[model samples]
Target: MISADTTPPLTAVDKGRVTLLYHFVRLQMPAVKVSEPTFLTHLDRTFRIFIPKAPGPVSWAAYLEGLYAVDWLVCVGCLTGQNGAWEVLFNARTGRSDCLLVDALRARAVRLYPRDEERQDTAVTEFWGNLIAPDSAGTLPVLARYDGQRPLAPWLIRVFQNWHLSKLRQSGGTTALPDDEIALPMDTPRADGADRWHETFIAAAREWLGSLTDDERLLLGLRWRYRLSQREAAKLFDLNEGTLTRRTDKLRDRALEHIGGKLVAEGWAGDDLEGFVLTELGSLLTDDPRLSADHLGRLLAARGKSLPAG
Candidate 1:
């Protein structure tokens, strides 16, 4: 038995394993030169972090290899300096790994998050933005636990989906409603109250529109702002005319649904709420020459209303 004061020597197998890991990391990050002693220290620390969390005996190695293969080390290096994995490993001692890793993952998150054409009727651009915002530190920790068993993009998508679901559950689900189901009471506010209500309604409408994806915004701008025919707009976007028509109809319905929810929450339900949303949206569109009053008129007409003349 070894004395308590004496350290055990590394076995041949252990030494070989260290040599393999050193060469693997060096090959992956040729630009980052690290002394053997520094590398050995980082390797020990990395294993301590990785080993208990690994799924199998071989998983830790697989994860390290996969990270290198995907150039994640290079990305971390670029984020800190051009020094590659050495910078990352050095900074890891200072607890900067999460920040560097999250920064590296952000571009992939943006690319993988569900967007306009992917989902049937929701705009997720703002959802992605909110997930990556500085206030979302709770979400960033998930990156450290990524085992590299799957490609990073798909893994990140799954994480985002779960985060979105949790957010929705916490917020009591989505605020949007079906168009036909949105009926507001017809009571009109007095002249002085009308101005205040109109201002409030306009603010809500702007907020809802701002939440839409860029593609959704562009589609609205093309159809309403530019007054393009369905066929003309379809050709511009290289989409089939029927597809564009359906997409535009869904967009309008989504807008109505979002605005309707806000009104109901504010205790302003009934025909007055419907009227307020439509009238204010129309008025807002009228301010921009690019947005056609006739287009707003047509949308209002579908809901059994007409645009108020200037």
Candidate 2:
């Protein structure tokens, strides 16, 4: 029997079993969630973001498990540190091993928690080395033990930095919508206010197009006329993506507001813009691919010309 003062020595077979469990646990860690307020509060403070913000109450048990995985990743990183001094152990049957879930935990940590450059470089170097090592057994056990001891500061920082970088690339240093090709929900019911807004949008588009100079016309054509995504349009016009996005949003908002006012001018007195007729206008804007100010002008002119005189 092992003495009370002495730690039990793990045999070679026991070590091998533990190593296998370590990998298994790392693989499974991502699925865990932490819902307890205390744990979540701690995670929020560490990561600087509220996680898994569900529309309603979340499954707390699952959330707690996720937090546990975070704790485990820190330990694993320490085990695999440059001066690792312990063999990571695992018991598959008992479910105590956490290394299997490291991937997802690492991913989340990097995404939610931005870290300093120096620490990130070191952790990344260690992670890659362990991943490609000739014999994983030696490294995996050591990594598992390290992560079990430390708080996952490096991993969280790396995750946040990567997420920020990705957003920058996707937006192309501009605040414009990522893509011009939007897929809106089809189920949204038309309201009177929406209808009025639509009609105003069409009328305003016509009027605005008439006011544009030749250069402005060409730029507008390159964007809305050619149906280019923001990035594509930005490249054509030599404009920044974020700037273009902001410009478009501002333009759209102003146009909508103007349209709402136009309804009042037309003696539509419901006070709400929703009751106005706008279905045709919205359809004209969204469904037709060959939208041009010239084409729209011609269409509206034809409609006005066909109307009967009172």
Candidate 3:
């Protein structure tokens, strides 16, 4: 079960920071056209939604309050015909605004140019598709960091431009590998009995992969296929790295448990089940294709399974 933080609720210092932010916004946004009550309502809503959910180490409530202040400043600038003023305020308030801006832009591009659904190599496409979609909770953190610096839409476009450049660098002028070339290794059994076992294992693995939701598959692909470090993967997905790591570990554990149950149902049991699954099934079930058939056969042989005649 997930453990909840036992930290106390927002403190006096937090409230003080928020109060200061409230006053700052009220002072700076005098011409924003929003009534004080309406402005306060929006600020309260922002705090309610983001305070508990903010990424931490620092005071998330205070950070959000500051963002609230900046957002109002930007709104006032936009409202008063002060072009580009929002960007200046946002950049000045948050030094890391460029990074968030880049992420937002890439997210938008993914939505604008969705790939063909029938394509086999759609992992990268799916990654971005999920990132920018409306249902993605990952976007909340990004939104909380938005200080109204520049219009949101233009900032997102700039992010897309950066993403496009990065993608070009990653491609390195090479075409993608064919599907068959990237197929998972299959064990060719020397005996009919071994062939049956091999087929059974493959079927189980495919079924397990199929059982995962699109988001789960995307996470796995990012970590395994793209070989991204947890930090890089988390940033791309708009998650805290620690949260991403924990979720990835949980997914792996769940997959292993399910696979173990399948093996037990097939009359395999004992401590060796986990070792076999991790060593044999684990290698075969990866997104990487470099694990040779010969290597796979050796692994199966170690498990006391002889191959069937082709």
Candidate 4:
């Protein structure tokens, strides 16, 4: 359950909020022709499809809204761009202090272009053969021509590092995605700006749902909440797809039993726990609005605290 003091939900992609994105992209990717509608679509797809599904109807709109409210919109833009190279560099800096960027670049370059002497590393093998082969659009050979011992240009890599670090220092926390995951299509068109705003809240809900202990809740988060492919979810949880299927089925049954038992214990014979959970999350956001944003930050921060060190 969330505390009562949280602020109302507001999103960056809300009706009039995307003028900033339009202005920013107008300057950064001048050749790419990013518009309000197109940026909104990208933001929506990112919020709706990018997060785990346990939290019900989580929305990035609120999170992004706060980000923009605090003038962290530039970091958000960097993450959502066509190539989030600087974003990836920013994320890599969190755990490292001394020479983090340089070390990460060296590690990334080594993994990207391994020597014949170090062929045993799987990350290296996969980087060239699997990762680049597909995303290159047949221009990988051209890229490799200049990348012998060094895959990326030294100066370009430095620029990416500098840009990412500057944003991190300015914002105080991270908001970017990795570089490899950004795959904006060349000819994407205009979208309804509202779509992005709606999805942000939904993503936040999914994040909350992921925190629950019930496997049914987890399954619900995975299938309907997060909209993740079962295979993808299985990989994330370190289980096989078949195992996930079985576990989810069992979870559904057990959840019903547990809910029914609790309802009976509470003097309500037929009350539904699943429905209660769903309705509670939905109503919490819709009724209060402010809870959506405040709860989301608390939920995310709490989860971050519980994660173990690698």
TM-score of each: 0.31, 0.25, 0.31, 0.28
Summarize candidate 3's per-residue lDDT along 1-310 as a digit string, tens digits.
1112333255787667656656765566554455556545555544454434434443435344235254445544543445464444334321124334333333334333345333322433443343324325556323343333233434334343444445645866222221111122122224545555555566677678768764566567656544668997677667899999998998888877887777778876346666666665654544222222222333335545433222
Candidates' C-alpha lDDT: 0.49, 0.40, 0.48, 0.40
At residue 116, give the lDDT of candidate 2: 48
Q: Any runs in candidate 3 off by more than 4 Å, and if so which?
A: 1-194, 282-310
Instruction: Give residue 287's error in model 4 in angstroms.
Output: 27
State in Å the error of residue 237, model 1: 0.8
Candidate achieving higher TM-score, 1 or 3: 1
Better of 2 and 4 by TM-score: 4
Model 1, 232-275: lDDT tens per residue?
A: 77776678999998999898787778877776677663466666
Answer with 1 or 2, whichever has the higher lDDT: 1
Residue 64: error of model 3 in Å? 44
Better of 3 and 4 by lDDT: 3
From the highest TM-score down, the ranking of the candidates is 1, 3, 4, 2
Candidate 2: count the clashes. Answer: 47
The better-scoring model by lDDT among 1 and 4 is: 1
* Cα-lDDT of candidate 4: 0.40
